[model samples]
Target chain A: MNANDPILETLNLVKEFKGFVAVNGVSLKLKRGSIHALIGPNGAGKTTVFNLLTKFLAPSSGMIFFNGVDITGERPAQTARRGIVRSFQISAVFPHMSVLENVRVALQRRLGNSYRFWQPENSLLQLNEHAMALLADVGLETFADTLTVELPYGRKRALELATTLATEPELMLLDEPTQGMGHEDVHRVTEMIRKAAVNRTILMVEHNMSVVSSIADTITVMQRGSVIAEGSYAEVSANPQVIEAYMGTTDTALQGAH
Target chain B: MRLTTYVYIALAALAVLAPLIGLYPVFVMKLLCFAIFACAFNLLLGYTGLLSFGHAAYFGAAAYTTGYLVKTLHWTPEVAILGGMALAAFSGLIVGAMAIRRQGIYFAMITLALAQMLYFVCLQLKLTGGEDGLQGVPRGNLFGMLSLSNDTTMYYFVLALFVTVFLLIRRIVHSPFGQILKAIRENEPRAVSLGYDVERYKLLAFVLSTTLAGLAGSLKTLVFGFATLSDVHWSMSGEVILMTLLGGVGTFFGPVLGAGIVVALQDNLADKVGSWVSVIIGAIFVVCVMAFRRGLVGEAQAFFGRKKKTA
Candidate 1:
């Protein structure tokens, strides 16, 4: 992978909340068409970085460049429209809507016809086939009619990814993609992420080193709002500073992995 | 879907027969106007999950606009109503733009403050007739052909508009656009990250809701031959919310039912209870909120849902 062909680059990013610095001078370069994982101790500001990249939270200082264009000042929706989509750490879906409608809403954005209130909803039925295909990709085809809130916890994360995929993202920012998932779900979601990463760049904050080791193309380790090390999983896990950051934390490199 | 047409027919038939069935056409027509207003508010509050405490602003603004247009400018009833609705939409755009910046209770407060501002402004403006209100707003001829001066004729005219707006609202709630609105209502941040531009959607819903509300307000002025301060008052805003809530927030005909119940209570009780009608309405609202928070339509739906599951 070309390290210089950065799809997303943050320059000295900082986010402060009422004098408490959440993200401090952290810069990251995501390679084009690669799965880059950011692993760090809890509260190391990995989620804040995701929020800043998606413009959910404004950076106190520094800049965000997407495909070489500065997108630091863009609104969250504007950032999403520019081919940057994100998934939340918690399962994020329209809980009252059926699983199929969840993806259809995202897919409908491409048609530019969601604003046509007069048109019969039968017009949206045309996109149902496409929505189901995305659902099938996520193994949610059987649950298409189920209201999203009825979905089990791990399944909701998959639905979030399915919805994220529906955005047709050029760059996907996933926060804790497999957080709180059981063994099987972690495996399924990890494989899904690997499958979904084709032709798109993914910057995910993952805690599961086994998952990272298996799927992540490169890993960036952060400590106290700063990057402690960056390289392949093998390289970063070997670094002393990276080990110290996760010393007291249950997650220490690939130690939790089999 | 077939059920809707039947429901509409049944509603129209009942409304058409109400005058002959011993109910005053004028009173029923007045109730219908507020029903329309509630349905419009329901679009934003029930469907979009936006609590706008200032909706009376659009309703009253249109009432005044339509009253002024017909009484002074001599515009046709339909065009005047449209003029009022357009103004309502414009004001909705501004109020919505500012209010949508905040969410939940903050959103409610912004709308309240804006509506109160309009209320006071209406007080000083000569166009609004100060506190006197724009009175003698003629019923005017429908298209300058069918005279609406007859109460029965005006009742039927209002019924027609009610049906149209009702169906229009139903269509919007079920359309792809409506789907986005519901998605925003369900999970706003998710809608935004999915590239739906939730703020723009919120503003659009707000404008649509307020515009329809204006239609109802304009009709009220035409119905009563006046647009008074009561129409623009903050209490009017609270009343619409009660109507929607009591009738079943978000249910298609809930606001209509809610408006009917509230208006009937006010009308029936006002003669007997006088100004204390407010106290009576307040008691009923408190009881409804405490007992069945879902409103009438919502409770019925829940009841039926439970029964179906059991059966």
Candidate 2:
């Protein structure tokens, strides 16, 4: 494919639950290696779009193309296998598993032994070094043996990122990865995301304007189930319509967000 | 060695010496059989977090199949047990495929529905002996030479399988496969997003659990010389859940201890209280749930851990 071609594309995607349209006539192109951010106000159908792209929710009509391959109608797991990995807005980790074991759960799938119950688990220690490396990347090496449920909320988010990283995806879809995290965690995670974005494409639904401005290479602003603007942070942030979408035509500029 | 290792050896010693010390061999065998049932059920409900209310279908299917094969075709005990496992696996596949489509309470409902169908078939089908149940299952020689006819001999035979399964379960729980099951149990949607075909993992867990439960049923048939309606009833399924919960739902030794207590209560109180046995069991279940939600072994471990901390 051409370098100019989008690495991922959705043509006129529409999702309706019952009679309400959640995502309507949305079309977009994600450039190769770009840190694309999908930002919108509450109820703007951002999460619904993520769900549709990952095949968690079947679209009422439209298509999803990944790396120029038609990947619509694939199973949710099939979507994941096609190198599109998404993280939940809620922190997701196996609670009872040790922090190390949580990351190993993701890494072990690549070892091609997902169904070998007869073998001793000691065999899985071979993955310990790799699992520990991922945890170390997230600064979680010290808490390796701690149960995930007992970790503080912010650390759980970091562990969630670590587990997501263990999947080694080509395209990472992060849904509000820093939604409830404190300021310090948000900056740490933002830096971690920038570090993690080295060789892969990241499409994130982020609300933090400062995060969007700092790291997002391209911003797609949605207003009530449609993309109102798409451009660099400077272009989208400066647009009056984008400003109206957020602050509702108030005298205060969109600058109020930061 | 660790303290747990010493505890295991001591427990093994007790099991080996039980019949000699006047604990009835048949009673011990019966409890062990139920222990296996509870353990198998725990693998699904406790580990996988899939509550299957219809597990009796697989257990009873194996018991009935073994009863038929041994009583009529005169199959060897080893072959007969394998036959029972195969039937259980097959039945488990059918039940699991349909049941796993719905989750949580709905999943439990569907399994219960399918199992009730199996129970009716057992009650109506002539092959299952209708109401009289599949009776006269033989305790034939284990390998065509070593007899299981004597209660002590059969006890060891059953004991060997029990110990193997206990360790096997611990291994499985620690295995990579078990980790996937735990991931699913902890967060199913997240597991799906991780590219796991969650339905397949759940189905496999269901099949493995049913087959183990089937092995226990087959042994019970051979032990008691019968596969009766009680084994096939919905109450049997509920009883297994009770055993798991009473002993501790997710703990490794919880099911074993729960099965022991439950089976002991039934054996001792059946003559004294008649049908009041169920009422007593129900009371115990409520008391256990309210008083010790962690289960006997789980609470013991927590208590022990506390004592260790103080010391």
Candidate 3:
């Protein structure tokens, strides 16, 4: 897509909690049909930025443009209806609900039938079929009837992704999609994210350098509530500030992984 | 199969056999009143994760209204009871608005405070007849056509209303709106992020629960032929919560079981030990919380769930 076709844009967005600035003067553009990676140090404010965009938190100052519309201070549900969906950093899937039921609830919310109460739930064949399709796409078809809390961590994360996808978002905000996972689990999730990016734009806050380098078309390095560097992985890898802020820290974690 | 369906079947069987049980119809009517109370209580604490300590306000308010309409205006039982339900719904809306401003323990405290205020109003109000209450309340006619003075007729009337309300609650729990409420209970922040208006959903649920509580109170007043301070007391609120906890908080039919068990215990033991019934409920609460968080039906479901897995 062209530069004019940006799906999401932040203009000098700032968020502060009391005296501490969680996200400061952060501005970024996510092009349509692209996988953009937001990389940072431990307190980089990447998740804060995601929260502001999704309307989970109001920005201290600035504007959020989604699909070329100003959506800065809209309610979370209003923003979600506009196709800006975010997965939680802590896997926000309903633990008491079955995997399929979780997806169906999201799907129902999207289809505008979430408020329908009089009819029997099983009578909604179209909704059920669509929910199953979403579950199948995320490789959770076998675990459809299983409670989300009973699922393995990797599967819970995948089910979370499936539930998010059920909202029919045009742009997905994933907060640390592959967090707390082994190499094989990371690989599986990276593949799933890559597959998901085929039809929808993804702005993900990822800590894993390997996953970022493998999948991100564009990478923005953030440090202490600001974008320190922005470019492709190869370009950012060569930047002195990015090298000192990100690579220096990532190398130590990489070595510690062994 | 869902345990709720089985419980419904069992309760239906009991209703059919009520006449052969050799029990007083008035006792069964009292049990039905508390059953509705417990179910209404469940809508908050069980499904919505809200702890309301002022349900007694709605329960007692409706009772007084129904008793006044029947005793003063000489209206039929049905009209008086419907008026009571409407009055309860209105009062619930007002109190629920204020109570919902606080959550968790604070929510319970707010409800208790408001209910206490209502209790004082009842005590001072002349229509409530002070401690004497509105006496000589004619059970009156069902629709100004069928007499409700016969205990059997009145028992079936109350039973039919109880079953209808119970089924309505079940339908609500299984609905999409109920699912969203559960999501709010499970993880509110996530539910909010998913585009649900968490506060609006909560307020709607609070209103619904309170309205149902009112209906039950109105029916109770008609059956007992008086409205007393007992229904409005904070202890009544505690009793409903205890029933829900004893039956199972969120599960369908749990509150019904809780209501029946608690009412039966009180009816059976109150004659012998008087007010010690509260002590026994407190003991059950402590035991249930410590060892069995699932209550009676919840534990049964869990047991069956494990068995199914093993099988």
Candidate by candidate, in order, the iRMS in Å equals: 0.7, 0.9, 1.6
User: lDDT by residue for model 3 over B1-311, one digit each (tens)?
Assistant: 67657767887988867867877888889999999989988988888889998899999999999999988998888888888888888887887778776878998888889899999989899989888777677899888899988988888998999988888888777888888888888888778767787777888888888888989998888888888998899889988988999999988778888988888888899989988977987888899999999889899889998998899
Better of 1 and 3 by TM-score: 1
In the range A181-248, model 2's lDDT, one tens digit per residue, is 89899999999999989888999999889988899999999988999999999899888998888888
Give the per-residue lDDT of model 3 (tens digit) for A127-203. Answer: 77888888898888988899889999989899889888877789999999889998898999999999999889999
Off by over 4 Å in 3: A1-5, A247-258, B1-11, B99-102
Candidate that beats the other on DockQ, 2 or 3, i.e. the better one: 2
- Write the residue-wise lDDT of candidate 1 on B146-199 in tens digits: 899998888889988998999999999999899999998888888989887888
Q: Quality of candidate 3's docking, in CAPRI categories?
A: medium
After superposition, which runs of candidate 1 have C-alpha atoms over 4 Å from their true positions?
Answer: A1-4, A248-254, B1-9
Give the alpha-carbon lDDT of every model. Answer: 0.91, 0.91, 0.85
Tens digits of per-residue lDDT, candidate 1, A84-202, equal 99999888999999999999999999888988888888889989999999999999999999989999998899999999998899999999888898999999999999999999999
Better of 2 and 3 by lDDT: 2
User: Residue A212 of model 2: what lDDT?
Assistant: 87
Residues B8-127 of candidate 2: C-alpha lDDT, one tens digit per residue: 889899999998999999999999999999999999989988999988888899999999999999999989999999999999998898888787999999999988999999999998
